[model samples]
Each structure stands twice: as C-alpha cells, then as structure tokens.
Target: MDMKKRIYLELRNRTPSDVKELVLDNCRSNEGKLEGLTEEFKDLEFLSTINVGLTSVVNLPKLSKLKKLELSDNRISGGLEAFAEKCPNLTHLNLSGNKIKDLSTIEPLKKLETLKSLDLFNCEVTNLNDYRDNVFKLLPQLTYLDGYDKNDKEAPDSDAEAYEKGLDDDEDEDEVEEHDEETVPGDEDEEEGEEDEDEEGEEEEDDVSGEEEELNDDEDDVEEQQGLKRKREFDEEGEGDEDD
Candidate 1:
C-alpha cells in the first residue's frame, strides 16, 4: 500500500475528534479514492493537494471543518457544486489548470464567506461578469485571486482603460450634438426676422404709390382749370365780334 492509503487508513481508525490538519500533498490517488479519503477525514481543518493522482471526476465529501483546500493540477471535471455544498468553512482553494467550464461550479462557493484566496488560472472559464461582485460581495476578508494580489496597481489598469474609453465616447457624442445644434438655424427666429422685413417693404411700397397718385391728381386738376379759363376767353371774344 502507498503512503496515502496508509495515512488514510490510520486516520480512519483514529477518532474523528482527534484530527485537525491533513496534508496529503503529491499523493497518487484516483478521483474515487480521493473522495473516500475526504469522507474519512471530515473533521480535518486543512487538506492539501491530494488530487495529484486524479484522472476522473473529483468528488470531495462534506468536510464541515475544512478551512483550507488545495486541489491544484487535478484532471477533475464537472460539478464544483459539491465543493461549495460540502466545504462551508473553506478559506483557500486552489483549482488551477482544471477543466471547469462554467461559473456554476464556483457559484456554490459564494456562501463561503471566509474564502480569502481562490486560484483558477488556465481554466476554461470565459465569463467573469456574473461573479465579479457576487462572489466577493460578502467576502470582505478576501484579498487575492488567481495568484494576483488585489492591491497590485498593474492589474486594474485594463479596467481603468475601459472606463476611460467609455467616458471619451460619451464626450465625443455630446460634442457632436452641440455642434449640430449650433449650425442648425432656429426656425422661429428666422421666420420672425423675415416677417419684419416684409412689413417694412410693404410700407415703403405703399408710401411711394401714394406719392405718385397725389402728383398725378394735382396735375389733372391744374390742367382742368386752365382749359376752363381758355374756354371763357374764347366765348367773350366771339360776343364782342358779333356786337360790332
């Protein structure tokens, strides 16, 4: 028997209340065998790197006392819901280089308020949006993730760049709208100015027409008076000649 089996058998024979920490690092055990070990060591507070020999589905039994878990470099696939449901007190989890595809595998882990560090490097995970706030929302004690320190200044620069790009796009849109407004003519103001010019033009035309009409009427009156005088003189001369 290997050293892992011997240690597992020893722990199994001992009372559960006596065990606190279990370190089976670099051990060679398949997924099914690992599950059995976890069940046998349920009272253990620390479990480290026992999945090194796993080549199939990884099953971690309900270990309520487990505080730290390290399962790095395991070929385990599918169903992390078991981990979240089983290990409620887990604080540190290392599942780097696994084939975990969806966020659902990690969803059950959200309840672990004590989880401080989570390693998920080189996984098949594509969407980090859903777990962005929900996973860490309750875990104020958490500080590190995926081997990157949260306080590292170099990490957030990409997020900052995205935010700046969004703001710049908004500013450009606003500037375009303002420029359009300035160039466009106000219909109400243009119509009012045109109406005032039309009224002034009509008044000037009416004044000119009235002056021409008055001048024509004055000339007609003067000509009529001159004709009456000429008629009177001709009649008087005719009477004189007849009388002689």
Candidate 2:
C-alpha cells in the first residue's frame, strides 16, 4: 500500500497528535519520495519507514520531537543533511542496506549533535578501511555504530531488550524450582527404601533366635532320657546279687 494509506490504517482510531510512534514499513513511496505524511504528527517520537524505496528525505516533515528513525533498506545514497533540520532531536538513525558508498555521502550527519547511535550495516561504506574509526572521528557525538561502541562493547538494553531478558530470567528461576521439587520426592523414596531394608534385617534376626531356642530344648530332652536309662540298669544288677 501507499505510505499515506498505510499511515491512516496504523492510526487505529487515534489522532495524529496523540500518536507517539508510527511504522510505515514496506509501503510504496512516490518515486523515492515520501507521501501522505504531514507535520500534524508533531508528537511522534519514533518513526519507521523501512524499505519504502526512499532515496532522500528532502520531503520529510519537520519533527523536532523525533528521537529514533528507521530508514533501512532504501536507495538513499546522500543528502543526509535533511535530518539535521527535520529531526533535530534524533538520537538513533538506522540507514543500513542503503547505497551509501563513502564517507562524503554521510558527512552531512555530523550536524546531528544529539545523535548517539548510527547503523550503516550492509552499505558500501562499511567495507572501507578503518570504517568504524573514520565514522567515529567524523561524528564524535556517536557512541555506537552497527550495535557496538568504540570499545566493541554492545549498547545498553533498550526497553524491548530488557523485557526479553526479564522473561529469560523468569524461565531460569522456574526451571530451578522444578528441579528442587523433583529432588525432594527422590530423596524421600530413597529414605523409605532404607527403612524397608532395616525391617527385613530385623525379621531375619528374630527367625534365627527362634530356631536356636528349639535346638536347645531338643538337647535337654536327649540328656534326660540317657540319665533314666543308667539309673534303671544299676537297680537290676543290685537285685541279681541279692538273689545269688
């Protein structure tokens, strides 16, 4: 769809003045020129027109409140000076996948004093020798280029990044809790198994004691019978002597 119609659809029953952000990505522009956007969107803070076939921002409406702009995947090679006057407060500008071939094409961005992050990924200029160093020197106000700083550290979290990180943290905590829960049951089962083994060992000991008592009783009965037999034999011999 055309940029104008797309913007209207994205409004979603809100007036332009009430809108804080707008996205018109992949919309057809009129021969690389923006259309259907007006200055009434003064309250807009973020605007994205990615892959809209824009070769220049000369027709861009004045947006003093704009902070971030996404214009990646266009044919824009130069004329970046328009941003200095149009979006004076812009801090992050993404012009990746464009036709920017050299430093001179982007030299106009130096006027953006508040600019902090600039992305030129997939552009011809990135292949130049000492690209990052040159860009940093050209725009001293820039703290990051292509997502990294002069020291190669990543930029701090944005609102979206922080939200995603929080979700990951929550998932990790849940996994730990599940692991602890599972371990408790396993420990209880181990303790129960040990108790069962102890009970079996006690039963075996009692059975051995009962068998030993029965064996002792049988031995006492055999001795008593042998003593009675000896006493009877002595009496018979005495009677025979008396008869003789």
Candidate 3:
C-alpha cells in the first residue's frame, strides 16, 4: 500500500474524532485510488483546516467547522462548486501548483463571502485573460489573490494593460528605475514610437467613423424610397375613391 492509503487507514483506525486540522501534505492521503472521501474523515467534526497538498483526494468529507484548506500540487481538476457548498465557512484556500486550468471551476467559491484570500499560483488558469480581474469581480470580498493584495489598485492602466497582454511579465520592472539613474540615449526614439502609435490610433478611428456615416446614408435612402412608395399608394387609393 502507498503512503497515502496507509495514512488514510491510520486516520480511519487510530485517529480520534475531535481532530481539528488534517494536514496531509504532498497527496499523502493514500494510494490505490481510494473512493468516497466523505467516509474516511467522517468523524472529524471540529476539523477546521485540511492541508493535503500533493495528495489526490478530490472528494472530501463534510466538515462543518472547516475554515482553511490547502490542496496545492495535486490532480484536482474541478468540482470546487460542490466542495464549497459543503464548506461554507471556508476563508483561506490554497490551490496553487495544481492542474486547475479552468477559471470557472473556482466561481463556486464566490458563495463563500467570508473568503479573504485565494492562492492559484503556478496554475494553468493564470494564463487566462484578466485572471485577476475576473477573480476579483467574482469574489469581491477577496482581500488577497495569488499572494497579492486586492486593494492594491495603484498600478496604472498602461502597466496593467501591458501585463494583461503578457508583454510585462518577461520584462524587468527595475529597468526604468535603473535607466533613470543615468542619462540614457534613444529616449526620443521611445517618444517617437508613442507618437506613431497615437497617429495610427487616430487613423483607425477616422476609418470607423467614415464607415458609420456611409451606413447612415444608406439607411436614409431606404427610408426616402419607402416614404415615396407610401405616398404613391395613398394617391392611387384617393383616385379609386373619386372614380367610384
């Protein structure tokens, strides 16, 4: 039997019921693909935290007073919604270094309004667009995400936008501060690039405005043709009435 199974058997056989925290880091729950975790730790009523990092225990037993949970570096793909329903008082969650690719899987955690911090570092969902934005919007009560504070709104939009676009991650943030300490050449070239970008943006806007005007003119012409047709129909009806 693997270490995880041995440890689980130990929990079932020897562990007491009043155990508050069950931390089986590194998926040490057991081997041989144990099924139905709700039965394994069924007696741990006062269990507050379950730090089973690197374990493959996807389904957990119902713990009423559980608050903090750590399940990093495991094969936990989904089923966070059902898990959140059973553990409503959950505050701190660490699912970093897992196989979590879908950001939607954690949407269920929004129901736990008491949740203050969430850790999804080194996960595949970090590659999603506006990962931090969507997570914050989903869980407004969250004060921290991936170790960053939620109230840190000091970053300018240009920096945030570049970070979202993946252009800022590989670049060193200290580059500008280092450059500021000395008289750097080619500063004007950067300004010229910005000017060129602004000009291109203006041209694109002009093109869009021209397209909209042409569409409006086409609509006006169609309305004029319809008005003329209606007038002609009314005249024909009047003539028919006079002939009668």
lDDT of 2 by residue, 79-184 (tens): 8999999999999999999999999988989999999999999999999999999999999999999999999999876888889999999999999999998787
Highest-scoring model, TM-score: 2
lDDT of 3 by residue, 1-244 (tens): 3445645654655554545555444333344222324543544433322334333434565665667777666656677775566667777788887778876778888888788878898889989998898889988999889877766644234547876767565455566767665645777688899999999999999999999999999999999999999999999999999999
User: In model 1, which regions exceed 4 Å deviation?
Assistant: 1-6, 9-16, 31-35, 38-42, 55-58, 126-142, 153-244
TM-score of each: 0.48, 0.68, 0.49
**Position 121, candidate 3: lDDT:** 84
Between candidates 2 and 3, the lDDT winner: 2
Ten consecutive residues with minimal summed lDDT in candidate 2? Answer: 181-190
Clashes of each: 0, 0, 8
Stretches of model 2 off by over 4 angstroms after superposition: 157-160, 165-244
Best by lDDT: 2
C-alpha RMSD between model 2 and the true structure: 5.4
Per-candidate Cα lDDT values, in order, are 0.69, 0.94, 0.68
Q: How many times do residue backbones clash in model 3?
A: 8
The lDDT-based order of candidates, best leading, equals: 2, 1, 3
